[model samples]
Target: MLREALDEANNWIGKVPGVVMVGEGRAQDGSPTVDVWVTQPVSLPQKVKGVEVRVRNSGDIQAQ
Candidate 1:
Protein backbone atom coordinates (compact mmCIF):
# COMPACT_ATOMS: atom_id res chain seq x y z
CA MET A 1 0.00 0.00 0.00
CA LEU A 2 2.73 2.40 0.96
CA ARG A 3 4.80 1.39 -2.03
CA GLU A 4 1.86 2.06 -4.33
CA ALA A 5 1.38 5.53 -2.92
CA LEU A 6 5.10 6.25 -3.11
CA ASP A 7 5.20 5.20 -6.75
CA GLU A 8 2.13 7.26 -7.54
CA ALA A 9 3.61 10.34 -5.89
CA ASN A 10 6.98 9.86 -7.58
CA ASN A 11 5.25 9.66 -10.95
CA TRP A 12 4.03 13.25 -10.71
CA ILE A 13 6.32 14.85 -8.15
CA GLY A 14 8.25 16.65 -10.82
CA LYS A 15 5.10 18.50 -11.86
CA VAL A 16 4.78 20.09 -8.47
CA PRO A 17 6.73 23.25 -7.78
CA GLY A 18 9.22 23.24 -4.88
CA VAL A 19 9.14 19.47 -4.42
CA VAL A 20 12.57 17.95 -4.03
CA MET A 21 12.07 14.38 -2.85
CA VAL A 22 9.45 11.78 -2.02
CA GLY A 23 9.80 8.57 -0.02
CA GLU A 24 8.07 6.09 2.19
CA GLY A 25 8.13 6.50 5.96
CA ARG A 26 6.32 5.85 9.18
CA ALA A 27 4.32 8.56 10.83
CA GLN A 28 4.65 9.54 14.51
CA ASP A 29 1.81 7.14 15.24
CA GLY A 30 3.62 4.39 13.32
CA SER A 31 1.20 4.44 10.41
CA PRO A 32 2.57 4.33 6.88
CA THR A 33 3.16 7.66 5.17
CA VAL A 34 4.56 9.20 2.00
CA ASP A 35 7.11 11.83 2.96
CA VAL A 36 7.52 14.75 0.59
CA TRP A 37 10.48 17.14 0.88
CA VAL A 38 10.28 20.56 -0.68
CA THR A 39 12.42 23.68 -1.01
CA GLN A 40 9.45 25.86 -0.10
CA PRO A 41 5.85 25.71 0.98
CA VAL A 42 3.52 24.22 -1.63
CA SER A 43 -0.04 23.04 -1.69
CA LEU A 44 -0.43 19.26 -1.67
CA PRO A 45 -3.09 16.72 -0.95
CA GLN A 46 -3.39 15.52 2.63
CA LYS A 47 -3.62 11.92 1.50
CA VAL A 48 -2.83 9.92 -1.60
CA LYS A 49 -4.39 6.56 -2.43
CA GLY A 50 -5.38 6.14 1.22
CA VAL A 51 -1.86 6.84 2.53
CA GLU A 52 -1.02 9.90 4.55
CA VAL A 53 1.17 12.52 2.90
CA ARG A 54 3.62 14.46 5.00
CA VAL A 55 5.39 17.47 3.58
CA ARG A 56 8.52 19.07 5.04
CA ASN A 57 10.52 22.12 4.03
CA SER A 58 14.11 21.11 3.26
CA GLY A 59 15.35 24.44 1.91
CA ASP A 60 17.42 24.36 -1.29
CA ILE A 61 19.05 21.04 -2.17
CA GLN A 62 22.48 21.28 -3.73
CA ALA A 63 24.80 18.65 -5.09
CA GLN A 64 28.06 18.34 -3.20
Candidate 2:
Protein backbone atom coordinates (compact mmCIF):
# COMPACT_ATOMS: atom_id res chain seq x y z
CA MET A 1 0.00 0.00 0.00
CA LEU A 2 2.85 2.34 0.85
CA ARG A 3 4.64 1.59 -2.41
CA GLU A 4 1.42 2.15 -4.34
CA ALA A 5 1.00 5.57 -2.77
CA LEU A 6 4.59 6.48 -3.60
CA ASP A 7 4.15 5.33 -7.18
CA GLU A 8 1.07 7.52 -7.48
CA ALA A 9 3.00 10.42 -5.99
CA ASN A 10 5.87 9.92 -8.44
CA ASN A 11 3.42 10.08 -11.31
CA TRP A 12 2.19 13.44 -10.04
CA ILE A 13 5.64 14.97 -10.01
CA GLY A 14 6.85 17.00 -13.04
CA LYS A 15 3.24 17.12 -14.21
CA VAL A 16 2.70 19.85 -11.63
CA PRO A 17 5.10 22.74 -11.82
CA GLY A 18 6.79 24.00 -8.63
CA VAL A 19 5.92 20.81 -6.77
CA VAL A 20 8.32 18.92 -4.51
CA MET A 21 8.04 15.89 -2.25
CA VAL A 22 9.56 15.52 1.19
CA GLY A 23 9.77 12.32 3.28
CA GLU A 24 9.56 12.03 7.04
CA GLY A 25 9.04 9.46 9.80
CA ARG A 26 8.34 9.34 13.50
CA ALA A 27 7.38 7.06 16.39
CA GLN A 28 4.45 8.50 18.26
CA ASP A 29 2.03 7.02 20.78
CA GLY A 30 4.23 3.90 20.79
CA SER A 31 3.59 3.29 17.11
CA PRO A 32 5.95 3.76 14.18
CA THR A 33 4.69 5.68 11.17
CA VAL A 34 5.94 7.14 7.90
CA ASP A 35 4.77 10.20 6.01
CA VAL A 36 5.24 11.92 2.68
CA TRP A 37 4.92 15.68 2.52
CA VAL A 38 4.22 17.21 -0.90
CA THR A 39 4.96 20.89 -0.81
CA GLN A 40 4.16 23.64 -3.30
CA PRO A 41 4.77 27.38 -3.39
CA VAL A 42 2.49 29.33 -1.03
CA SER A 43 1.64 31.91 -3.69
CA LEU A 44 0.11 29.15 -5.78
CA PRO A 45 -2.78 28.75 -3.25
CA GLN A 46 -2.14 25.03 -2.82
CA LYS A 47 -1.19 23.87 0.66
CA VAL A 48 1.06 20.95 1.48
CA LYS A 49 -0.38 17.59 0.48
CA GLY A 50 0.64 14.43 2.32
CA VAL A 51 -0.06 10.83 3.27
CA GLU A 52 0.75 8.81 6.35
CA VAL A 53 0.97 5.05 6.59
CA ARG A 54 1.29 3.34 9.91
CA VAL A 55 3.92 0.63 10.42
CA ARG A 56 1.90 -2.12 11.94
CA ASN A 57 4.48 -4.72 12.84
CA SER A 58 8.22 -5.05 13.12
CA GLY A 59 8.25 -6.96 9.84
CA ASP A 60 6.49 -4.10 8.11
CA ILE A 61 9.07 -1.64 9.35
CA GLN A 62 11.86 -4.04 8.28
CA ALA A 63 10.38 -4.29 4.82
CA GLN A 64 10.67 -0.55 4.43
Clashes of 2: 0
Model 1 has an lDDT value of: 0.89
Instruction: List the RMSD of every prediction in angstroms.
Output: 1.1, 11.0
The C-alpha lDDT values of all candidates are 0.89, 0.38
Candidate 2, residues 1-64: lDDT per residue as tens digits?
Answer: 4455545545653245444442335546643233333343322212123445422222212223
TM-score, per-candidate, Cα-based: 0.89, 0.35
Report how far residue 4 has shifted in candidate 1, in Å. 0.8
Task: Report the poorest 10 consecutive residues by lDDT, candidate 2.
Answer: 54-63
Best-fitting candidate, measured by lDDT?
A: 1
Model 2: how far is 1 from its true place, Å? 0.7
Clashing pairs in 1: none
Off by over 4 Å in 2: 22-50, 53-64
